[model samples]
Target: MKKLMMTATALALGAGMAAADTIRMGTEGAYPPYNFINDSGEVDGFERELGDELCKRAELTCEWVTNDWDSIIPNLVSGNYDTIIAGMTINDERDEVIDFTQNYTMPDPSAYLALSKDVDVDSGVVTAQTGTIQAAFVADSGATLVEFATPEETVAAVRNGEADAVLADKSYLVPIAEEDDSLVLLDREENINMGIGMGIRESDTELREKFDAAITSMKEDGSLNELIKKWDVGATFD
Candidate 1:
């Protein structure tokens, strides 16, 4: 009888240990200012820091994994990650697949970048990553649209004159344009804000609630705002 009790206690202890809190996070780790690999090859960016902070607040161990932007969602659905901390814009289309926390970061309007004197945002054809908001804009405006695999490729296309304009996140383009005098910023006056939130599996309501609480605490304490300013992330959380 004593042996049976001991065995049951051991099993319960093991189960408790297995259920100890740990969170695996996914990010592109290539989108600068949001999340990217640093020169040291470690993930670094506003989103990365925010994830770390939130995990700390929730008393959970965090393990970050890098995945391609296009596959981030699919991986989350497959249980490859407990949550996605990448700079994913929260939209109705995405909500159909996964549940998201409240908006932690807001999106800025997609902007155009082109080589000086060679491209026109209003007249020439513009290209963006296929299935992106910028691509939707191109389709609606009847502009010639080109597709690329990555943001880097789209920017390269503009530089090489393969595409007249590249529409992407303004925060990404502004820094690149400032560094390269050959590039010019277009559509500075447009403001399109898209809310960005953490992605979780459709059934992970418990985890989602924890993350949402952490985010709400961060925003209330001004930590989120400070991180946004420190990183120069294009959009505001408020």
Candidate 2:
């Protein structure tokens, strides 16, 4: 949901979202099925489609902006973007920094990926994307947490034996595990389950309401569920 690129092209893209009627939709453009840069180098994925629809429903012009995951929230607070449509999980810690619209996605389980099912994920070295809840969980669980800048790097750490396992959203890992013969999902203990929502600045009450209403409409009309199933991200909002 977050990635940072300060190239001239990205800056121009950000400027486009700054138009009077355009709501900047910030994302990581690294998390697949959620957000990613496609072959055309444009933001493309589930959140891309969902954000566009939400903006349309809210009667707001919107444009996509990519920022690094580690600085996603900070950039939003700094007025670099109007809202974060990144696949951010709403939680108490995050709430202190930004206000989230009603959740667009239900809670998803985090998973552990390793080369073997029998790996001791609880105590051995684990890799997680920097600035994610998965990293926090590993830190507190007494495991040696190796942080990576991107999700792919986290997976690479495990594959290269730099870490014993990679912990991340199960939705993101399932396909990788299925495609790779050497990787397997370790038996999970009810991992952190949290609803994913769009992050808006704390002071943007009216804007938050606009998005919340749009999300509510999507839920009522069943389009949100269709998108969730289509993207295979996780269960729909309930």
**lDDT (CA) per prediction:** 0.76, 0.85
Model 2: which ten-residue window has the lowest total lDDT?
A: 1-10
lDDT, model 2, position 152 = 94
Candidate 2: segments with Cα more than 4 A from true spot: 1-19
- Summarize candidate 2's per-residue lDDT along 48-67 as a digit string, tens digits: 99998887776676789999
* TM-score per candidate, chains pooled: 0.86, 0.90
> lDDT value for candidate 2?
0.85
Model 1 segments more than 4 A misplaced: 1-20, 188-190, 235-238
lDDT of 1 by residue, 1-238 (tens): 0111112112221111234345678988877878889988889998989999887776667888998877778888887877888878788888999989998876666778887654556657787876566777677775788887677889889888799888887877788898999888875434544667899887877667767888888888788889888888755566
What does candidate 2 score on TM? Answer: 0.90
